[model samples]
Target: LVHILSHSGLLLLRAGVQGLSYAYLTALVFLHISREGKRVSLPRALLTPVPSVPSPRRYMCSLSLFHYSEYLVTAINNPRSLSLDSFLLNHSFEYNLAALSSWVEFTLEKLLFPELKQITWLSTVGLLMVVFGDCLRKAAMLTAGSNFNHIVQNEKSDTHTLVTSGVYGWFRHPSYVGWFYWSIGTQVLLCNPICMVGYALVSWRFFRERVEEEEITLIHFFGEEYLEYKRKVPSGLPFIKGVKVEL
Candidate 1:
């Protein structure tokens, strides 16, 4: 009974956090598109096409590759980002079941996997990782401000330059690194041993693929400048002082 109540409360908390984040992002996207006007097409601007402009065919070709790559990466990372509303309206019992299935992960990890559920320093470390990592992730976004985006943007229009200082100084993609640890830490804090492994493996692959794609896009956009920055900075981590990956 206590376990059920606790899980229920955690689910509600997760829902609340996701709802607030979605609302905030919606508001930010609306404001940005409203101000950008025609350079970025309406609604379609979400996909980021510049069809209204005359034939700068070469630029368009590069942009088309960029936009599609960004879209694919977003879809891969967040399969529901663009279509959650339609899903909400059409959801059925199965959908609710799927939503509630998180408890199964919780149960399996906390109950069946004693190796994972044991109390250890990892619990404290995981707690700190979630808290500090989340804060750092937010700070990276806020620091970059409007320049921050899930989609790669043409640097020509953004108000900020390549973020090579601050969080950027910490790692080339500090936000991704923060999120990577933050996610792994979630399973640790939850005492879900199986999920800790799953999270670590899954997030590593996702981020590795995503990071590689992003660097390609960055090199395309920033040329030698980004290459130089890449050399100077390690690839976003608390691997920070000691380790560096030259992605």
Candidate 2:
């Protein structure tokens, strides 16, 4: 940032910083909500807190297990699940890349074309994309409820049935759909055209591989029901029909 300031006069870095800030805020919101450990109407829950029946206990019990416990859950389920670790890691990678990409693009564009300037409309559109994309991805997670665990299991528990409602009604992988847009939005919000393209390509490739692997497991678990679901609903992109099944 100091180097960018020395070259590009500081305002150029703001967009990059802002994009990173949004990612941070989104992560914090998700983490806090997820840790609260209940699947309820988040807005209502936050706004209307229930009075405690018992006195507030002064306790921090580390021994008590939580669903979001990464290590323990990983132990319980399949560690090989790409949905568990890889997707989250990819989420971080996408944001980090946007932060760097935006900074680099701004500095270079400013230095290379000192007279020319980035268009205002691009920034406006980028901002909208970021906001909308974030909402879409987060909505998918919340809507899916218990069916939306971090892991992709070969053998699902009795309680863990397939989700085909909510956003899942229109798309097979709405979270992935949300993420695809969000990843691209991060790059665009930073006004990094090259990185935006790069993000799209990389993310699409990963989603392709991930969907193939995940759907095979899904088919095994859900049987013909999953096949019917796949036949009816598009996987990622809405217009994309006839998605090839690997297994």
Residues 9-60 of candidate 2: C-alpha lDDT, one tens digit per residue = 2322454765354334334334433324554332332333222110011000
Residue 117 in model 2: shift from native, Å?
Answer: 5.9
The alpha-carbon lDDT assigned to residue 188 of candidate 1 equals 59
Instruction: List clashing residue pairs in candidate 1.
Output: 171-236
| TM-score per candidate | 0.54, 0.58
Worst 10 residues of 2 by lDDT: 54-63
How far is each candidate from the true structure, as Cα RMSD in Å?
19.2, 15.7
Model 1 lDDT tens row, 20-96: 54344334333333333433432333233223321122122222332233323333433434332311312356434
